[model samples]
Target: MNKSNFLIVALVVILGAVLSSVFIVDEREKVLVLRFGAVKSVKDEPGLAFKLPWPDTVVRYDDRILSLDVEPLEVTPLDDRRLVVDAFARYRISDVEQFREATGAGGEQAIAVASRRLDSILRSQTREVLGSVSSNDILSSDRAALMLRIRNGAIQNARAVGLEVIDVRLKRTDLPTDNLGATFERMRAEREREATDERARGNEAAQRVRAQADRTVVELTSEARREAEVVRGEADAERNAIFAESYGRDVEFFEFYRSLNAYRSALQAGNSSMVLSPDSDFFNYLKSSGGISAQ
Candidate 1:
């Protein structure tokens, strides 16, 4: 070969070797340099990285916090109420070297393996923590504390997989669909019972008020009638006293006045007619100024 051709071939081989030995670590990723299936170094900082060429390799993993949505799981609380729980977690790769070792895989497969194992850990912790509390606690505002407990538990187990569990949260906690209808029915029945009790109490109060009002009305009417009778009797007694005084003052005049009242009452009828002799005793007042008999 010519010297010029050989020099050009050597320069090309050198350039390829340089390119093959170099890699980049992005700010969003962590890199592992492996030689013959063994980790040589880890590059987490964003910049140029180097590795031995041929049979040496580079593996990259995401450095950002990752989110995982857990599949809905059924749990029985301390109250023995079964609930369908949907949860999610936030995590990150804390140590890439440990992660690669624990996962026993390289490239993207490591992330998948770690995720499966972490999911199992998280689910177990979730069931354990949630089962220790009642359904009311799970459904109440205290759920934040429960979630913290779950995250803490998962954090402990996650270290084995080189993952840092940042947070765990319950997206939804609800009665199982099979039991939801029964629970609603029970609640409705309870509400109805309360309403019935209230209605009964109200009715009892209304009856009491009505009975009291009726009794008051009867008492008032009876008192008013008694007063009227007493007043009528007093008026009758006063009239009789005046008539007795008139009789004592003039006996003949009182007799004449009485006769005149009798005559008026007997003649008060419409179309009245009477049959009497001219000398009847009833005509004594007409015959004389006094009520004495006219001889």
Candidate 2:
């Protein structure tokens, strides 16, 4: 509780404060110790560490996984359609010195640079490949393959910054409003014209079919009439032949029979009567109604 006790407590506090500057590396992190703004020790592992107080500093880096989303790049499709594509990139720092130099300003600055690099690569690849693709192919599929190439390109560019890009993925790809309108209009017009042509062709074909059907109907009707006339004439010819043959069998009897048939057909109805010779078959028919008594 005296002056010596006060000095002792003050020294202990200063020593504790200086000891507080010691570096504590975690198992999940890597650290680089700098003294007087110069490289001291690059601790790649975890556990306890030491550093000069105030004049010495420690910079810890997570060698763990980190994700960065690059800004969207507007690219032209092979068919000249503009597409806005967004991509995400994943990376990790593998080398401490390389990372330190690469991330001069910080990981954030390094990420920004890498993002730019990715954007450039994506834009280049899209412009080169997608610009020459057909509209059908572009509409049907992703022609650019921006993510894969961009990831590979970013890793190559990021090597100087000590970055290990794990993967690159295209998050979104969409047509720009202007390009969308134009493309849609073109497609719609194409489809509409096709529909119109199809309708016209169908109508023409229908007309042809109707004309052919009508022709068939007329031909069938004419053929039926001709067949009916032929059949009637054949039947009439047969009847005449039978009559002729019967007459040829008995000439006089046929004459008498004909005379009687004529009288019956020509006779007036009611009280009207016919005046014929007594020898005629008319009188014979009038006398004998039982067909000459069959004797």
Q: What is the lDDT of residue 52 in candidate 2?
A: 68
The digit string of per-residue lDDT tens for model 2 on 136-214 reads 5545557345456556666676676676778876677777776777878977988999999999999999999999999
Find the candidate with the highest lDDT and give its number.
1
Candidate 1 lDDT, tens digit per residue, 106-222? 567866877788889988999999999888899887688899999999999999878999999899998888899887886688789999999999999999999999999999999
Give the TM-score comparing model 1 with the true structure, all chains together: 0.63
Poorest stretch of ten by lDDT in candidate 2: 102-111
The lDDT of each candidate is: 0.88, 0.70
Model 2, residue 220: distance off in Å is: 30
lDDT of 1: 0.88
